[model samples]
Target: MKDRHWRTRYRVGAYEVWGTSLDSEERRRNAPHAEPADFGLYLDERWHGEEDARTSHFVYWPTLEAPVERALLIARIKEAAAALRDGATVEVACFGGHGRTGTVLCCLDVILRGTTAREALERIRREYCRYAVGSAGLENFLLNDTGDLVTPEPLRAGEGR
Candidate 1:
């Protein structure tokens, strides 16, 4: 809500992914799909305002530290995917939707769609837009050979799988 400059939406697999560019009002107006159940992922700590919240399809806040943790990120994406499959529009946003948000988006692509982290990051930039992840550290993190892309195993609340 704080004057989103650039916003664009596009389909990624079975989900729609996008973010505001920066200081572009026009993009914000026509950005998100006009659905009530959309889910948004806010990367930054800034307040996006009450009106933005009310009108948003759905929103998720994952306040990550400077270097994002893989386990936490995977959990958040799982949550987002669940929401999206349940008839909600989803948005993942950081300050510029580049560094933090972009990194997470890449992870989501690999984890959900079976792309390698490196390949997924590259695909995100090539397909979504350049300047997606601004930090070299974040880019490295996404592409690191950190085992078999650790993801949360499905948990049954009251019973064993």
Candidate 2:
């Protein structure tokens, strides 16, 4: 929204993820041109919840170059994927709106649509952000750790923590 300067929107399976930058957050708070988020998955090394919106369920994920905590990553991905499937407008943002944001969105593609890690990653680069999944380590984690199909069915109510 606004000037399309900081955010790039994508549709993966049943969910819509807005890959955005911190700059968008600043612009949005000062004068919002788009609707507020129902959920936000923030993947960044430094930035936390500075623009906390009352309407959003924001999760801070400090990632990139960190060890692949598969359990935690899977949990967060599931939550964001579930929110997207439920038709809630969600935002996935990081420092540049390129790598980290792209990585998570690709993971959501795998969880929600049962896509392969390679397919998911390429999908993000082709459709969402061309230079996404920024870190080679991050990419390898998705390729190796994330099972081909982690969830066969939609998670039951209250399944995510």
Candidate 3:
């Protein structure tokens, strides 16, 4: 948005996820290029009003239980990946656009870039913003690598398959 270089455009399955810290309505309106379609993923609990529903935007009520439910997280990643592959822009956001947002951004990176969650986390910090501090638990979950399908068991050694 505003011709600023994005942090990363990652593909998860068939979608793409673009990470950013802009949460203003004006910023959202002007963030993406005209040719590229855009969607918003708001990771805040306060925006969960039922009347605020939209086709292109999702509002998740994050908590300590988990920033996102596992199923929802998987679905969001898949959807974002599809949007990216289709040349659409999907923006993921959090309150300060750092911790929760950064966690999701790292998840997309791991899924699309084939980088370990740790590596992705490092990359985000180095390239995206120095303040990007994703949740350590979420980082571990992304790195678990229990294959494309999430399972109850922890990913065994070398068991990304």
Say which candidate scores most in TM-score: 2
Clashes of each: 14, 0, 9
Error of 3 at 129 (Å): 1.8
Per-residue accuracy of model 2 over 67-95 as CA lDDT, tens digit each: 34556656767877777777777777766
Residues 37-126 of candidate 1 have per-residue lDDT tens digits of 255656554536512323232233344333545555556666776665676666666655566667767766775577777777788778
Off by over 4 Å in 1: 1-6, 27-37, 48-72, 145-161
Clashes, model 2: 0
The TM-score of predicted model 1 comes to: 0.67
Q: How does model 1 fare in lDDT?
A: 0.58
Better of 1 and 2 by lDDT: 2
Minimal lDDT window, size 10, model 1 = 50-59
- TM-score result, candidate 2: 0.75
Evaluated at residue 15, the lDDT of candidate 3 is: 55
What C-alpha lDDT does candidate 3 achieve relative to the native structure?
0.57
C-alpha lDDT score of every prediction, in listed order = 0.58, 0.68, 0.57
- Deviating ranges (above 4 Å) for candidate 3: 1-17, 22-37, 48-54, 59-61, 145-161
Worst 10 residues of 3 by lDDT: 46-55
